[model samples]
Target: MPTMKLGYLKVCVWLACVAIASVILYTVVMLSRRPLSLQTSRTAVFTGGHLRLWQPMDLHGIPLWDLLMLYMTQLDNPILKNATAQFNLTLPGTCGENFHAASQGLKNISSYPSHFQAFVLSMHFRDYSLLVGPADDEACPDGTQLLVAVKSQLVNFDRRQAIRETWGQKGLVRGVTVQTLFLLGKQGPGDGYPDLQALLQLERQKKRDLLLWDFQDTFYNRSLKDILFLRWLQGHCPSVEFVFLGDDDVFLRVDALVAYTGSLDAATQRGLFTGHVFQDTAPVHDSQHKYYVPESFYQGTYPPYVGGGGVLCSRAVATQLYKASCHLPLFPFNNIYLGICLRELGLVPQNHPGFRTFSAEAEGQEDLCAYKELILMDHRTPQDIIRLWRGLHDPALAC
Candidate 1:
């Protein structure tokens, strides 16, 4: 009987040993397949415009479940051969700051063959104002005092209450201002409302007059419709030094943008338009999409590249663009139309290194975090913006 009991105990000990071994093996496999951490920066650069920073992750050997799932589902996964490509990137920063130097170089490009102003100098520059769509509370620390023309859009009684209850109460963040704009007679295409009228009303009551064209509508309308509105806005806002057209989804690091503008002289800055410029000596032209603009529609050649989401145009450039818009038939595409207008006006589309029309997800910018340490535009959800603001609080995670 004693021998029988000893044998059973022996078997129990063996089972326990096997269970421990299995766990060890599983852990090893997971560790081996973990994502790699890309090189990092000591600090983040804040570019001009609504550039929203994100929550910083340690990024070291993080689990790749998301990546793996997407990879398996793809018939032609670009990621399978080079898994975690984004995680292996080398961003620009202190150690050589290669990316930063390259980006800064775009601003320094000289107008080699007698500056462009020499051509458009004859055209009178137009004064135009900007229309910032909506300001999600996440993007603004203090309401934009500069948008005096549209003060009501920023101030809201009900929203003020929500901000305190949702944000201030958590101790996660402080005052945040987000603006929402919409077409007349329509609320918005999204699930939520930001009380755009409240903002506009507040602006009106406060006697702020900075808004260029007050009519409400989505910018995604017909190209001709957008041009008409642009014309009205330029005509009305005579004090507009330059026009910055951007969406509420983005946060322009205003101070950074203003500082950069200060760095350039009036002459150098005039006739200057900057944003992400697509270049394809031979780009595929699709006419059906609203983005399609034919060369025949315009008097001159079709411009090589332009993106619509966020564009910066100087007063001189604005006048030339307006004049050219009339001669050049409207193209359904928002960016291409601007490109054609600029080209016909004999003005060039200067690429700004800081411009980011799309996030790393859409544009395939692998070293996005590092290159975007200082960004003019970054696409992020309002909730995402909240978290990003949180991560910045930790001293170790600022970069």
Candidate 2:
């Protein structure tokens, strides 16, 4: 009986050894299959030889499940790929010969006196006659206290209407004169609506707030829109004290912004270009991104730039930027192009606590006050804009 018991014990020990060995082999295989490059963050936790990782969030603050989705989708989604490829094909060659050889696309062939002149001349110099200008130019005049220029699409009539009702209403805000204008470019033939131009004309007659240009309104041509607006401003509305440049999708607290600007002394306001600024950001190398910059185009780090969702700049800075734009090549990214202009002018963008580019994810009712305090908030739909405007202005609601 003692011998049998000892033999059973031996068998149990052998089984335990085998089980431990199997676990070790399984762990090794799992580790070998795991992707090393996927660990973008250093905060990964390793447990039982398996890595648990965190991913960066999207613009909406949702966790990105796949890091390569942006790249993969470019290839997988045919419509998106075709659109992006068409834009890429239109991009002019970089300053280097290698890029010209590699891309074999549009080449810069102007033989100007200097590089600056070459850059300025290389841009498509088509003069797009304006379809509409400020209707009551004599009312606001050149000395308008604040001029708000909104970048808008041709079909965003609802958003433009929301603006007219809310903060964009042209009138006295806090004893300051505020004028708003919607800026747009011509719709391309592929936009599928032949009557868009006629509709725009009708809207212009009714509103008299549209500043339509004749350039093709593509996502990549946003910089052209900005520079052209600058040129127009220099000629048409030169004496405005401050200009609020923003997108139509943003919600602007015009009253708050006007009060803030009015509080500053005249000298302090002249040289200011303040917003939510990005510093030490590098150009994206991933070809899948809309804002990607190949090494042949720009190899250096991007200069600090204010978020284009909204920015408040003095007339002085705008003038300087316009001059700089004349010399700098047209960059695909409008905000980054503005950064390049600022770099050329030796001006740095100031960060304002009130300018927020991120969505306000409120924690409670009290958090609504935070939205009231911000100068601008991005990613707001037309409905969201109207709702927020009403909520903030509600007399009974208190923080």
Candidate 3:
């Protein structure tokens, strides 16, 4: 009887050993499948496994997921392969100092921008819910050819009004339907903003053109706003023929815009993303500058990106861009971030002379004739926008 008991104990020990080995094997295979540490391909080449930063294992954050998706894309597309290969070089401080700590469940990342820190925290806790927006398909009624999304703020009521009274008027334009929406983010008293909530609510009720989200409406959070808007577009206006994204302060020649877009060939229209293109630009390191980028934040030159002040993209491109954005981290500069996503998708931005983001030569001094040919121009005040719109549309005036 004692010998039988000993044999049973030996069998149990063997079975336990097998279970332990199986668990170990499974873990190793999973880890090897995707890189656990979110190191760049360049860093991986140099360290050869020495600097293992603690990237989140769940692949929930945009940065980590983007790295994985880029890696997968590199395997299939040679363009991504070359781009990834060229991206091989470790510059200091791309990831913040507390990256490892944050990965290990600590939230002491004060060195980064407040918006960036908020984005990081949002990875674990934030739904990015829509606070106010179009409630039904009527927002994009039948034959909607162009949807204009203008980024605006609570304090910019005058700009929104100017746009509405001018180029942003809804309904038909040049035989095609055009719709408009003003994108806004929440601002509260805690943020030093006035109590404009009631006024904004009334504005929404009267105009029915505001799309508000539950995020801070700060300069740095512009990228977040873009992402949220893209998500909303995918859900709401996915079938729209084209999209024009710009700021509320810009003057857009709606008639000229319709004419230009209508003239595009089918193929060009399918992938259209036209504006003032910035090519081979480097990130700014000046801390005092509004466009400052820390050396540790990003290391490469900017990809060809259309200016954010005004960009026009086709329905197909808009859809693809939304998909690409899912696999990329948000850059502090909203336009630059879109450029990075374009690089990931191997799409190049098209430069058009009509979209003059940085106003044309002597823009303030230019007569109506100079402005007549322009499609979009930035840095215009409410008065300027109104004056330009009226002057350009005058029936008695000939350019």
Candidate 4:
């Protein structure tokens, strides 16, 4: 009976050990499968000697846990697993098949004769009936010194107002003719903001500064906006001396910008495309990053291109770019795609320190004097832009 009792006790002990081991294994797996939170350091993944590739759309959308699992299973790299755990890095792979499929579609599109022309023509063309343009064609008649095309969202009335009241005001800047227009795309039913269309029309009636296209307004469709803008320019305002392509959020120093452009010789102005040029950058592979690019879409290195926040191109250069864009495949990154257009044109973007796309200084440490000198400063809120515009011209506050 004592022997029987001993045997039973051993069996119980063995079962308990198995249960404990199983619990430990389950706990580890559960932890591994958990997604990394937003609080995880982004810089650690990108900058800490760990190069990560990300898809632009998935970078912020996908969780790090899923990315790590994919890398562990596909790559079987224990080092990558450790790095993903340690730095919480997300890699690209989940949407690879989808991206490949889209790439194939693009390839099929390119297989046709005059594919680029056909693609451009397929974009629904809207006429001046819905446009709120210059009151008179003579207002921007031939020899207009500058035409500032501000890419704006349909719902951002405050931003458009601030721009109009501030640097985007129509008139002479430093004795040069400068006119501003807001570029917009149609807001579709899928956008879930049907009321915004009515408000947009009201704003258009009041401002008469809007340039609308029929394409769906979306972040991914910015390239379409750009192309449409080019086409509009070609059709309507081809004679403008120079074009300033900028975002609505950017603050432009109209006086300073005009002075700088006026100083450039006519020949130099014709071929000029200058801004904060990015060089030696690669497409991000992380699927969660907003700026991510898939290998299937782009396999080559990006050409040197200016930051899209603002770019100043001469009329001739703009025309050349528009022509070049027709032959190239549509790329999602508008600015980088512009670089490709410039590349095709055998031109290079000139980097200017005065175009501060990545902020002029560290946050909370902005130098007003430096800001005053820059032609373009990006990422400012509407109120901040107004304040900056006011301060730049404030006689009492000399920087």
Candidate 5:
């Protein structure tokens, strides 16, 4: 009887072990398909109706419950996994809509200087060390200046020393003090140098404010949607002159662009969404093509927004556009969507004569040339940008 009991007990133990193993394996499988986890908070906060989602309808009329359920159901279903790891999305909206979104509630215009000119310099700062060798040859011209706001992820604390030593010294160069709006955002707040305030406060003034961006946010893929915080400029701070909207690597002919646009209608100077334009077919979601618009996010066609690289829109126009975009839904691609919105609102993107959207790859070719010839912008490497900036004004090296 004792032996029979022992045999039955062993069988039961074996079965129990198998059941536990199966449960473990099942959990592992479920975890592997975590596209929309319970911790999904990738949403746009409607802080005063700034459109963050690039859709035709506003957060107003769209069946809120249905959309929520759809999103939640997708999150719970572990079998269906569709997640994108990118931080930029091209939403469907015209330029006019984008302008309106930026221009709403622009209060107390009289408080700011009536001649309140703006230079929207779009900058991207991936590397600060790159700024070392590129000396100031084509400096900020007379009557106009630049404000450099940089977003970088370089982890070294010592890097700020170099940045401080270079930019902090107010006496480095004379005649034109380049007003720097330097903002360096990394993976974390503590990631950058703690003593960076010296460089942060060039000419005894700190320009850049708090900027923390999480790359994992689903809505993070859309750049235009993310920049909705720009609405803070309205009615709060109005002493802004010439806001530049370009990336870090972009070598800008600031002197020339300023000289030329300074003479034009300062209130209306904008970009041409400069690139190859295809009319009427509408933007589709072809991953292979340059003009692909994703199907899941954007349903219909896209209006023209300027190429994201280098766009220049004045504060007045920006405010006007923002006002117009108040009731509209979010547009994904800021450049193209802004273009489409502007077209609808009876505004046009004027092409710059010096702008070059593409570059020809060849041996011994300089990437950018912003000399007296006045090249507006160029997409080049840090090394190339340094070289181009240095060589372009050399007087001898004429391209």
Candidate 6:
């Protein structure tokens, strides 16, 4: 009897161990399967009529939730991501519809600037056709590696000439075949400008690199420039490897830009979007400010965006961005609008040390070594750009 009791007691102990193990496993499985609390204050914040997900670091130590969020980040509508990770729990649809609807209602407001008015009109009507452009075959010829498309003002002929004579010259640098083009919009007498079409035509005939569209060339219309250019790029330069889009006023270190792009790994090269990044910035409510954003127009912080002074991106990324832009409502600020499109693709703009969009401290502004180390710098005068380019190329100069 004692032997039999000992054997039964051992079996009971084994059964208890098995039950405990099963309970632990069940708890783990349930935790993993639990519905992600996207509604939680810690996970999401409603802004600009969209839910912005918490940064990945914010959710540290929560592996199961991270996994769930990562899955959501891969969804078709990708606006939920922050700077590092993406998570969208909202109903699947383009988030820009809300922005379009909101801006549509505000079109009748008399206080809005003409640029903002133009942007609102664009949301409903995208019929602004390309008045003049290069032949599709000639825009980005075969063997083109880098296409530098400068956003030039209709009046900045000197600036365009300076660029062509220096960094914007079309040729092979470090074996990278480079092509340069200028983007222009209409600026005729109706907008208080003399008819410079004859001069423009002469320049175009000589250079064969101007992409002109039939839209007003105003500050707010800059976003329209981006949209129109992307469409051109999609149709004309589809096979080009890389593109550098920037203001005409900026100076470029083409060799450095090429080297930097060449160093990117295959994955990064395929999705490269790097420059001076702006994050966590909000639109100003002050009407006097250049970047004023009325609450009725757009609400929330700007997404991570490269400064418009200079941005470098791969053709593939540019293509994807163009597609993403289609679903987004036009933002007055060109850089911020591109950033929104990046968010729509679940992409975060990578900040690089080379792109200095804003001018450095006054002391370093003319330093040759400082200029040599950067890929691009903004707010440079045409003469200054030419002088700097010559200085950098001088054999006697040592960094």
Give each model a TM-score: 0.43, 0.68, 0.74, 0.66, 0.47, 0.73
Worst 10 residues of 4 by lDDT: 95-104
Can you write out model 1's per-residue Cα lDDT over 1-399, one digit (the tens) per residue?
Answer: 999999999999999999888766654433222211111111111223322223232333322222222222221222232432433422221211122111212211233122222212211112222443333332222332111111112323333232222222221111222222221212332525565666556644442222323222333332433454455445444444555554434434444445556577878777667777865433223545423322221122335555634576666676667655543323435566677566555567777777765453432223334533543545644443344444433466434
Q: What is the lDDT of residue 116 in candidate 5?
A: 20
lDDT score of residue 90 within candidate 3:
21
Residue-level error in angstroms, candidate 4, position 258: 0.9
- Across 41-147, the per-residue lDDT of candidate 2 in tens digits comes to 33222445553322222312111211112222232333233433422333222211111111223233222223323333334343456766755574256457899
Model 5 residue 274 lDDT score: 32
Per-residue lDDT tens digits for candidate 4, residues 1-399, read 999999999999999999988866654443333222212434223344533433121333333222333333333333333434332323333221122111122322343334232432332222212344545474365556899999998778889899989888887777788888888877756867555767876876777778886656766567767877886677676558888998988888878878888899878988989999999887786656777654433343578989948899998888888776554445667898788778767799999889986544444455667787788888888887877777777788666
Model 6 weakest 10-residue run by lDDT: 84-93
lDDT of each: 0.40, 0.67, 0.70, 0.66, 0.39, 0.72
Candidate 5 residue lDDT tens string, 148-207? 333233332233233333332221123333333222333334533344444433422332
* Better TM-score candidate (1, 6): 6
Instruction: Spell out the clash pairs found in candidate 6.
Output: none
Candidate 6 per-residue C-alpha lDDT over 235-270 given as tens digits, one digit per residue, 9 for 90 to 100:
676558999989999989999999998888999999
Badly placed stretches (over 4 Å) of model 1 are 1-226, 235-237, 281-301, 357-372, 389-397
lDDT of 1 at 211: 34
Maximum-lDDT candidate: 6
Query: Residue 212 deviation, candidate 6, in Å?
Result: 0.6
What's the TM for model 1?
0.43
Please give the distance, in angstroms, between residue 358's alpha carbon in candidate 4 and its true position after superposition: 5.2
lDDT of 3 by residue, 265-368 (tens): 99999989889898978878786777866554455567788883889988888888877765454566778878777776778999999988554445446588
Kindly report which residue stretches of model 3 are placed more than 4 angstroms away from their true locations once superposed. 1-110, 113-126, 358-365
